[model samples]
Target chain A: MHSPGDKDNGEIEALIQMMSRLPGLGPRSARRIVLHLIRRRAGQMAQLATLLASVAESSRECLACGNVTQSDICPICQDPSRATGEICVVTDVADLWALERGRAFRGRYHVLGGSLSALDEIGPEDLRIPELINRITDENVTEVILALSATVEGQTTAHYIADALAPTQVAITGLAQGVPIGGELDYLDDGTITAALRARRKF
Target chain B: MHSPGDKDNGEIEALIQMMSRLPGLGPRSARRIVLHLIRRRAGQMAQLATLLASVAESSRECLACGNVTQSDICPICQDPSRATGEICVVTDVADLWALERGRAFRGRYHVLGGSLSALDEIGPEDLRIPELINRITDENVTEVILALSATVEGQTTAHYIADALAPTQVAITGLAQGVPIGGELDYLDDGTITAALRARRKF
Candidate 1:
């Protein structure tokens, strides 16, 4: 037989379970956030629910560049001002967002959706790699900057894309390897230190 | 003039802002969660939105003990098996949930909503202290367990309640101070170690 407490309080428990599944939230933090939301029911909770629904309904991958957008085409892909003939290729939309936040790159972006993973059985078609190559020719892209992570899988995907785009003869570059801003050399791993030393520029 | 990217993406930005306001989530993590949700729109995202809306509409504080419930009275208070004439007083519903998870305490609970804080100007009347005293006589409560935190405000609230319930001559108790299971002595702070030492059992 179901316990009285368990039977009657299933909704709250279910909400907690769903929230706990979100990235960066565990069971303890989920409980705290749920209670906090419930207490602010009139304001934050209602606002959050509305936002979640609207975002879920409206948010979609940009048909052209694979960036998230509320419309058919993401802002960057549609904006004439961003057409600098340079496409920054990133592994995910989050990276695209990060590049936008930096405000340093005036060019557009191509989100790969994810890196190629053989172990996970993910291939070029699994991501937006074919779409990216198609965009280079159709959009008359002059350069492609590979802003992928420096992991082994990231390198493998970058190399595959580079070979594919070699026929197009577009200038492809990866992000510079170096000590990050505010990163101490002593705390950095041997591999990073070596990469940084090799790629060191003259002041 | 609005930036091309910023103007069209207001809804996504608003969603991120609201998500960032949630406890334990910052702007970066909020963006990550939002992106993840958007990607999982067909399943987890829609499910979470539905649950949030339903929980917001249905969940209400129990009229008796202030526990969150779909009904007027919470399950613990309504359960015939829980009428043990003993009440566990907790500073928050999370604590009540934790105690219930232990299953060591079979009695019902009284949620104070929060501890009294002089600096924050939270008084006895701000909590459910008055209702608790009334419950003692109305429910024929035999014992009151103060399962509040070991913070100063928690102790002050416990002492105040102890004094208030003295006239009824009911047995009062607090959670024992001790080294938690799987807790290492080296990792424990001075205060916890001291408390554990003082309350050491002759095992």
Candidate 2:
């Protein structure tokens, strides 16, 4: 039998459970969010439900670059203007979106989905590395910028991609390592400081 | 024209905005949650959408005590076994839920929705104060425990309720203020320490 003073029914309990599974939310925050949604069911909650349903039904991985899209070919891959010879490769769609937010890179992106992890037994075939290589020849790509993270796995994936695409004779480069725009030298890690000093330009 | 590298469509963007509006979630966490949902669209995302829709359609405020329920009266108000003649008055449903979780309160609850605030121009009519007063006579309630916060507004509301029910000859009480369980004396505020000292009891 369901308790009287606890949650109303299984539906509410199930909703809270699902919400708590989200990346940053916990049980407490999930309960608060559920209550907030319940109070605004006629307006914000209804809209959110409709949007979630539609987005779930329509969203898919872009066939070209593994980025999420509502269609087989994402807008970036279909756009002629974004077909610059440079393909900035990233580890996930989030990185692609982050670079897009910066609005610096005019070329398209290749989302690898994840880094090369020997611990997890993840290999090149698991990621979109092969598809990235195919694009180099098919799209007449000039540069393959490795915009991967500074982690060991990220560097390993970058090296593996560079080696895989060496036969294509494409101009491959990695993002410059240095202090962040507002970073303090006192808070800098040893590796970042070393990289910044070694790559220091005539300022 | 829609940007190529930004979010795929307005649905995803709208979903992110709605998620961000949730308590404890910001824009960055919302984006992360949206991406997570999109990736698991066939399973978790679809389930959440369906649950949200069903819950929104079914939920309503309990007619008696103002607790959230799927019917006219909440299960707590409906249960005859819970008619202990003690109505625990709380400032919000969240507090009621908290007390219920402790499993210490055996009686029904009266949710005031909010505490009285003179600055906010909220009066007795603004909350469920009148309904709470009616429950005292209608339910043969003996003790009305004001499980409200220790804030100025909470104390003012408690005092007003006590005065309102004074003519009825019903017993009224407030929650004892003290240092919380597992609280350290050094970290506690002066007001809490003073209250705890005044409420000292024999071990």
Candidate 3:
């Protein structure tokens, strides 16, 4: 039997360590979350565990577009109406989910898994770039929207994909750069302000 | 089959909602965490699920001390070496865990579940105060240290417990009010500075 002073709580410690590895949670937050879960073990904890297990066992990446789903093909890729001759390519499934939340794009998506990173030695072959190229020709795609971030890797990947798809004659476009929908001029960065000025339209 | 803009991802949405309810996590963080878990479903996510299930099914409050445990009694209460005639009382299991992390106290602990709250109609019967008084003679306890918070409810509970234990002939004590170990005098609150001055000891 160990005293409270002993640092040998196996299960609880393991839970905290795992939770802390999550994106937004640190060690302190993880400990607080674990304690909260323990207190609500009969209700929320049990429900969360059940949902996690279900998702873990069932959720799989779409074979066509790389979006997460309970089947071989994700719901977005499987939906026939979404094949509107346009494909929005993103770096990861999270980005895909974010686009889904916006509910403005009535098209499919291509998840690249990650951007081209020279430091990490990640290249076109490492992501779903080859799959995305094949998708353009196979699905009679008329346009491909590069919805990647404004980072160096994102730009490099977008340019590489555009050059590759040039022969296929598909209209390749990138997201417009300017002030964000709800952005204040005071908070807008210098680079964004410059881009917005240079890309001014005759409105 | 749903499109990228579809708002009917039931399972995924449910998972996000449940995760947001955890302490220190809001809806945005929950969405990020859910997407991360889904992406890592084959590894960390699966491990998390297994651990959550195991803990949810097994972890229970210690019958003797109200601390979280996997068995009837917590390790602290079961450990014969921890019968040091001193018991530190806390308002919650999280408080007990916090004290355990410090690892300076060698004695056992008693969890009160919550403090006295007249507004919420909580009294001694709502907490484990009666059990604490009974443990004095049962455990041959010589000292009862109130390690509750400095809040109004905590003080009220501490005072009530002290009065109740006055008949047991056991020494009732509260944690010292002073500047925290690493706190600076300049940044310290007026109440703490006053407490520290009143309790000043000669070198």
Candidate 4:
């Protein structure tokens, strides 16, 4: 019998292998997903294939900010109303999208594509640090908000950027570290509690 | 940044929505998968799309036992060596594939597609129960081993099948329920412990 895992079922097995390579999916879940898709082949499966092809053909990085986009420039970078003399620097497009979902930041963004990692040998040049410095003067930016993760590598990258852009004289700031909205102190981590206590402001 | 969630990025948003509908994926993970796919568009993404298309076009249910196959008859059903006069019945193709992976069951399989569910108004006609009965007689089967789940619906279906096949005078059996291999007694539930004790045999 040509079992689902058998080499004879090449396409199905290959599809499952490919799916398992995606983030948050493993071989078992990939097999289940493939089976579900196969059952709905006429509807979701066909549509998914079409969408993947189209997205693959069109999707590209925004030349200005390293954000994912269909055009050379992302919509936020192209929007005149959003050019508010402020740029929120993020470590990745996912983080940029997350900040956009909050709808609190109206300024444009600069996606570094990844954070500084000495162990991985990633440096400033490997990221968009040079472009960010150029944007400070070219775009007449007044403030730069570092909305990077609180991880050590993220902080190191933030510090490196702040030092590199020192000559540009742009006002550099970072996202506040404290208790998140609706977060309970009992469940909070030690570092978070310490940071929250140290950054206490007028209540 | 036409935010990925925005209507402007229609294809990307649609792809994420479709992916989120998969068994183990949600919106957040779907977005991550889509981003990962887009990043590897030239290679993995393209290959995945091609594989999905091919599988969707070729895959179908095995006419004999309802197992998923690329042709009308599944390989297991078509194989002469698998006609061992013993048919192992399962609730779904996933279960059938699981049994195949073990490589212990050399006989053929009968996929019921789903178990009996009174709440869902599913009846014997809805599943492949009638076809299974016909196969027992036509294939000169001697034993029917029910490899159903431990769920109430699975047990109900198994009992119903046994009663229906009683007239055929075929030997009917079920999978033994006990502590799973490598299971700790402390971690096992009450039902498993009771069944294991009742069915204890000389080691």
Best model per DockQ:
2
Candidate 4: pairs in clash: A75-B1, A76-B1
Instruction: Report the lDDT tens digits of candidate 3 across residue range A24-70.
Output: 89877898898889988888888899899888888877889998777
In the range B1-203, model 2's lDDT, one tens digit per residue, is: 34545445667778888889898898778989999889899999999999999999988889999888887878888777799998888888777766666556678999998979888999999999999889889999988887777667777888899899999888886656564544332234446544543443321
Model 4 lDDT tens row, A1-203: 34454324567778888888898898788988998998998888988998898888888899899988877887788777898998888888887776676566778899997889989999999998999999999999988887766677787888899888888878887766674654432334556644543443321
Better of 2 and 4 by DockQ: 2
List TM-scores for all candidates, in order.
0.85, 0.86, 0.85, 0.84
Considering just the first chain, candidate 4 attains a TM-score of 0.83
For model 4, the superposed segments whose C-alpha errors exceed 4 Å read A1-7, A179-203, B1-7, B179-203
lDDT of 4 by residue, B110-169 (tens): 989887998999999999999999998899998888877766788789899999999998
What tens-digit string does per-residue lDDT give for candidate 3 at B1-203? 55566433468778989898888788778988988898788898889989998888888888889998877787888787789998988888777776666555668899999989999999899899999989999999988878777677787888899889989989877666574653322234445544543443311
The sequence of per-residue lDDT tens digits that candidate 1 reaches over residues A142-202 is 8888766667777788899999999998888766666465443223445664464344331
Superposed Cα deviation of residue B157, candidate 2 (Å): 0.8
Off by over 4 Å in 1: A1-7, A179-203, B1-7, B179-203
List the candidate numbers ranked by lDDT, top first. Answer: 2, 1, 4, 3
Candidates in order have lDDT scores of 0.79, 0.79, 0.78, 0.79
